[model samples]
Each structure stands twice: as structure tokens, then as C-alpha cells.
Target: MYPKLPSLMDTRIPTFLKNFNLQAFEVVGYSAINAKYQADFCHVSVKDAVMKGGGRRVHGWALWEFESHIVGNFHSIWERPDGTFVDVTPPKVGTKVIFAPDASLKITDDGTHQTLYQNRTSDPGLPYIDPLGNAANHPQWMLENSNPSLIEYCKSLGWNNASMA
Candidate 1:
């Protein structure tokens, strides 16, 4: 059993996301047309990490992109006074969140269009601070420490495949 997680509407947005410089880059070619008329917003993706010792885990959240339209399970970005980002989708008690510097952009196959944004980092093992205040192996460690309430919440949100792993 696990403690109740915060309500989805109660989590706050991070300051960096709130003040994210949308004008820092321009949409080019075909994507630009979509940007002009669509509602621009940010995307958040939930990630997991497990500890090496046992059934301890920590979940991490990443900002996927600043988009002209909502896509998938993406949620609005939130900020903290210290300029860190937070995703309220999961249980806040034992979760760890991170921002991958490398995921802050998107490029076209033909090298014609480039968009400034952030997305999930490819490396699942990215080191992050755990709830215990120690560095833990991500994704894997997070899986081990899965919270029942969060897992149930995720399932309620339609992540039927959500697992302790």
C-alpha cells in the first residue's frame, strides 16, 4: 500500500517553464503555419527508475516540448520558486524530476526545420537525486520503488499497462 498522491490539479508549474522563452526560436517551413494558428503549450512525459537494492523506485518527469497543440498525455508545465519543473501526474512524495539539456530541441530529417524544445532523454540511466537525497540509477531504480497509489492513479488515467516494474 502507498500514501495518496496529490490531485492532478494541485501540482504547481515550475518557474523556468512559466518563463520559458518562447521567442528564443522561430518555427520554419511547414511547422510554422501550424504554429501560427494552433494553441502553443508544453508537453510532459512520465518516466521511471528503479534502485539496485530492492523494491525501491523513483519516478522522474521531463518536459517534452513547447508545442502549438496538445499531443498525447501531455500536461501543462509547472514551476517552483527555485526554477525547477514539476509534473504532478505522479505521487510527489517519492518522485524525482529532471530536465535533460540535450532534449531541448527538435530537427527535421532534411535539416530544413529546427525547433527549440525539450523532450525525454534517450538514456534511461541518467543520474538523479532520489527521495532519500542520494543518487540512484534511474528508470530501473524507479521501477523497484513503485508506489501503489501512483500506479493506481496512472491506471485510472488510462495507463493500463502501468506496472511496479
Candidate 2:
């Protein structure tokens, strides 16, 4: 084993948050008991983008436990230097989120940790929370300008629930 990794504070938690535009991730389904959410059905809320949910916390800040259940990737969706959340996933707009540590596991008795990689194609896939500058939307900033179709698209995707996209 490489060695038991330290707490979120001890690890590279801060740097990760600085990079995130909002929430750490977009959780798509329930993994422990069963997968209740489908690939297309899950919609995580983002923070501070002004869709519905919106707010900004200090960097490297620690959020609550429930904040984690929605997003699972811990290794990648870590924290920021100011102690706020740095969401790598497509953020919602303004939802306060925290890492759900229960979503992850240590997987060893010796103490070292191994991260389980996740993606849209994988089980418990990665949630696409990136709300801004989507080239597919044409010019990306269309989100800010509030294009008619973009508004409808954002509504259909449940922008209210997203944390920081």
C-alpha cells in the first residue's frame, strides 16, 4: 500500500476546489443499494451561475455530508485553496455542496487508498454539470445572453438543482 491518505484537509483538497467553477461533481444515481437515477434522468445543481441556485463560498471550505451523496468522485472533485468547493462537473448555478465521503471507500485494511475512476460511460457515471461555454450550444456564452432555446434547454435540464454550473 502506498500509505493511508490523510483527511480531505491533509490531502490535495484545496487545489481541487480552486479549479472547480462550482460543485465538485454531478451525481447521477444511488450506488450502494441500487442505481435509482438513470443516465439521462440525473440532474445536479450548480452554484453562482445565476440560473436558479446561486451563491459563492470561500475557497477550500468544507460543506455538509449530504452535499456529497449526489456526486461520488472524491479524488478528482476535491477542494480549493480558499477552502470552498471546486466543482469540475457542469455546475447548476448556486447550490451549496459538500463531498459525501460515504460515496467513496478506502478498499484496504492496510490503510492506503485507491481511487475508483468514473466517467459518463462507467457505472454510476459522471454527471455533466458544465453549464457554461458549451460549444455545442454555439458560442458558449449563449447561456449568459439567455437565448430563447438556451433558456428552455436550461429549464429542461433542471438548472435549479445544479450546484454551481
Per-prediction TM-score: 0.24, 0.19
lDDT: worst 10-residue window of model 2: 133-142
Q: Relative to the true structure, how large is the alpha-carbon lDDT of every model?
A: 0.27, 0.28
Model 1 stretches with alpha carbons more than 4 Å out: 1-100, 104-128, 135-140, 163-165
Query: Per-residue lDDT tens digits of candidate 2, residues 5-115?
Result: 224452234333333333353222222111221222122212222223334322222221222222223222323344444443432322323443233222221222212
Q: Which stretches of candidate 2 lie over 4 Å from their true place?
A: 1-10, 21-36, 44-165
lDDT tens string, model 1, 9-66?
3212232233332221111111211121112222111222111112221122333222
